[model samples]
Target chain A: MDANWIAIAASVLLQSSPLIIAVCGETLSERAGVVNLSLDGSLLLSALAGFVAAYFSSSLLLGFLAAAGVGALMALIVAFGSLALRQSQVAVGFVLTLLGDSLSAFLGQNFTRLPGPWVQRLPIPLLKDIPVLGPIFFNQDLVVYFSLVLVAVTTWWIFHTRPGLELRSAGERPEAAFARGVAVRRLRYWYAVLGGALVGIAGAAYSLDVKIGWAEGHTRGLGWIALAIVIFGGWSPLRGALGVLLFVATRSVISVVLQRSLGESSVVILNALPWLLMLGVLVVVGGRFSEQVLSRLPAALQRPFRGLLRAAPPAALGAELKEG
Target chain B: MSRPAWLPRLWPLLPSFVALLLTSLLLLAFGASPPLAFGAIWEGAFGNQDRLLTTVAFWIPLMLSSLGLLISFRAGLWNIGIEGQFILGAIGASWVALSLQLPAPLQISLQMLAAMAAGALWAGLAGVLKRWGVHEIFGGLALNNLAIILTNYLIAGPWQPPEGGSFRGTAPFHADALLPLVGATRFSVVALGLALLAFGLVVLALRNSAWGLRLKALGRNPRSALLLGVSSRRETLLAMAFCGALAGLGGAVRVLSWFDSLRQSISGGIGYLALMVVILAAFRLLWTPLVAFFFAAVLSGSVVLQLRTQLHSSLGNILTGVLVLLVLLFGNLDSLRAWWAEWRAGRRRS
Candidate 1:
């Protein structure tokens, strides 16, 4: 029973790697005040591009690079359309979402269902010998390790670094950031692209690691889930990673527990769990009413509850930057 | 002295040409002849009376959804959950069709009313969530998925046909429950009339109503509108419910006319397509139906484009998506001019 539990935990962690990467990427972009609403479409296109590149080049690195390029190009369009042309970010992103989906379907016709190169598992020799923790953390492929490291590195860079401060300021108060000579628009452009590149990596991760294969919608609704996690995590990388884990764990538990008890057909309705959870989390943690309820909690419980429940978007998020 | 009178009016349309050019380049990359492919699409959409009627059948639902979107967009709401509203509307209609045995006209009327109410309630849930601090986008997205799941549940569970459970859909409605069609084609004069009436109502409501002014005020500046005694919450809910009602009615029309049963993917991204229609029309009342018709034609034609060229039907989606994006980018002549002048000034500086 214990071994089975360890196996489940390891599988959940493995399942969560791509989502963690995506949530981190979206969190980074949102931190810089741009919502990459094209994620769902971008993921599909990048997954296709990534698989096709890896298939042709026989290199996982090239595949990731290709996917990242696709992601960055899409983000560049969003940034340019919004920043340069003064278009609505939401409008441009939404259009790109549809465009990316169709573009992938149209272009990926030949590549559908084709097998391609995937990342190989590389268990750390000594670390893999350890007890329960080792199997869950160290006995995984490079993609999984990269996701784990990325969460830590992103959290540190966003919270502890000077450039991160500028990025935050660009999202939070661009006028003030501009007053302080932060180069707000430039920071937003770069961060949006960088975040998009990470999202691209997340896309490649799905095709090359987790759900390996090229298909019409290789990563379809997962991108939207990742976007939701960014909000659930309150735009923090560590919290976002935790949110992904929690989400994946719940989904795993549901599939295992509900599949046997309720039979096969009932499993379909259980697909709604994550969406319902998304709505519940938004309602429970996002409102001022939640904050008020938290304030009434016992003193020791209040602190942890506050940290878990604080949900505020960047102040200037999705607002068009105005230059004086 | 500088530009012709038509230039100002016509220049904004440059993006659509650019979009076509870009799509043609994409087709060329695929080693397909652009002219042949476009010709196939034209022939497929207008080849015969049957094809034209088929396109019109598809147009009713698209037109209805687009009209609904006009109200929501006017109030500055995204209504991304319109898909879910459409689904709920379908479920509502299906429930009436499956459970009741009424006269032809009564059955259809009940179905339409139930669909609108279901759609409005689903949209109102999103609006309520927004009031509770959730953005409509996220809430709508969650609701959309839930709506899909609900449809799946109904199809595979209680509403499952007596034979066995399958994801295909519930059983077909009785004859009285179905809309009166034009011979064998799915096109119905009743549905078309309703869609036209909806368009007229939307145009009138947007142009001349006092509520329209309030929506404009709210959309322009929420704080100022509130200060001016315009209730943002009430208006937001009303606009969403109104959009949902129309979208629901469209859903009913879809199941009754275009389809005889409540099937999986009932909305089939029609809600999203309607969004594109509204955006491409630049949210102008006069252009909504025309753009929608154009879209309906392209999509209908895509079936033939795929068969003739051996390309994916999503080619239609690609064309429209690119067009919408380009329009958003360079559609406004003033913005495009400003961007051009800025580029020139920067070049001179360099």
Candidate 2:
């Protein structure tokens, strides 16, 4: 039983690695005040693009690069729409999502169900020798390690570094940031595109590492979950990683339980678990109930506890930044 | 020479033309002849009386969903969960159709009522969540997923037809429960009339009613609206409920007049498509129904394109997305004009 639990934990981490990447990417974008609502469609399109690129070239690296390109391009459109045209980011992202999905379906029809290359697992020697910790963290593909590193790196960048401070200010108070000589619009465009490229990498991760093939709507609905997890994580990279792990763990457990006890119909209910869990988590974290709970805590504990439980998003998220 | 007054009026059409050009380029890249695809689309959407009626059938639901979205947009509420409300509406209508036995007219009316109620209830949950500090976009998206799951559970589980389960849907309703058709076409004149009536009502309400003015004021500036005696909470709830009702009516027409059964994906992305329509219409009431009809034609025409070119049906959706994006970009011509003038002046100086 202990062995089985460890295996489950490892599997959960592996499954959630891509999501961690996506949530982190989205956290960065939203921090810069742009919401990439195109994550779902972007994921699907990039998955297809990655798979196709890898299939034709037989190069896993090329596949990931292609995915990142697709993702960045999508993000660029969102940035252009929001920054240049002064349109709603949400609306543009939503339309892009639909467009991306359709384009993927149309373009990927020929490649569906075909076998393609997958990332081989690479276990670090010394780390793999460690007991449960080794298997859970060390015995994974390159993307998983990258995701793990991303959490620490992103957290440090966002909270510790000066550039990160500028990024935050761009989202939190664009006009103020501009007044202080920060190039708010340029920063927003760069962050939105960079964040989108990370999302594309997540898509490639799914196709080349996690799910391992191109299929219609491949990685469908997960983009939305990443969006939700970003909110659940309070836009903190570390917390967002944790949120992804929690979501994947819950889904894995529910699927296991349902497979043992229920038939095919239960699959629909199982599919909804992540969404319902995310909703519950958001309510607990963001709702008034959380505020009351925080107020009741001891003064010393309250600040830290509130920080963990109620991390607010950047102030100017989703708002159009105007020229001073 | 002074610009013609009508030139400003023609600005909106520029986006459509640019989108068409871009789509033509895309088609050429795909190795399909653009003119052939365009011809097929036209022929499929409006070649005959039968085809035209089918386009009309598509128009009804699209128009209704757009109207629903317009209401929410006017109230500054982003009710993204209209897709879920639409599904619940179908479930509600299906439940009434299956469980209740009444005369044809009464049954149809009751089914529609039940559908509207179900949609309202679903949308109201999001409104309540918003009031409780949950952002409506997140809440609505979550509810959309939940509603789809619920529909799937019903169709595949407890409410599975006697023939066992099929993802296609539950069994067709009794003949009496089915909506009456119009003159040999699958189209229902009553449903079309209802849609037109709803459109008329919405236009009138938006244009003339105090409630409409209040909703607009609230959307434009909540603080000012509050200062002017508008209750934000009450208006929010009303706008959401009304929007849900319109979306529910769209779902009802889809189920009763078109498919005649419940399926997991009964909403068929109509809710999202309606959003695109609303965007393309630029929130103007007069332009919405026309845009909806144009989109409906694209949808129906895509089938013909599929048959002729063997291209994927999603081409229509791609077109819709491209068109909307272009429209959004071109919507602000003043900014573009100003930028162009500044660039020209700077180039001459340099």
Question: Taking the tens digit of each residue's C-alpha lDDT, what string does model 2 give over B149-201?
Answer: 88878887767899885667888888777778876566889898899899999
Per-residue alpha-carbon lDDT of candidate 1 for residues A230-321, written as tens digits (9 for 90 to 100):
98899999989999999999888878887677764667757878888888888876776587798789999988888778778999999988
lDDT of 1 by residue, B195-247 (tens): 98998898889899999999989888999999999999999999999999999
Compare the candidates by lDDT and give the number of the best one: 1
What level of docking quality does candidate 1 show? medium
Clash counts for the predictions, in order: 0, 0
True contacts kept of each: 0.88, 0.70
lDDT of 1 at A218: 73
Interface RMSD of each: 1.5, 1.7
Candidate 2 Cα misplacement greater than 4 A, ranges: A292-302, B338-350
Q: What are the per-model DockQ values?
A: 0.76, 0.66
Which lDDT values do the candidates have, in the order given?
A: 0.89, 0.88
Per-residue lDDT over A132-251 for candidate 2, one digit per residue giving the tens place of the 0 to 100 score:
898888988899999999999999999999999999999999999999999898899899999999999999999999999988888878998899889888889998999888888888
By summed lDDT, the worst window of 10 consecutive residues in model 1 chain A runs over A261-270
TM-scores of the candidates in the order shown: 0.97, 0.96
Indicate the worst ten consecutive residues by lDDT in candidate 2 chain B.
B334-343
Query: Runs in model 1 with CA error above 4 Å?
Result: A262-265, A295-304, B1-5, B165-167, B344-350
Best by TM-score: 1
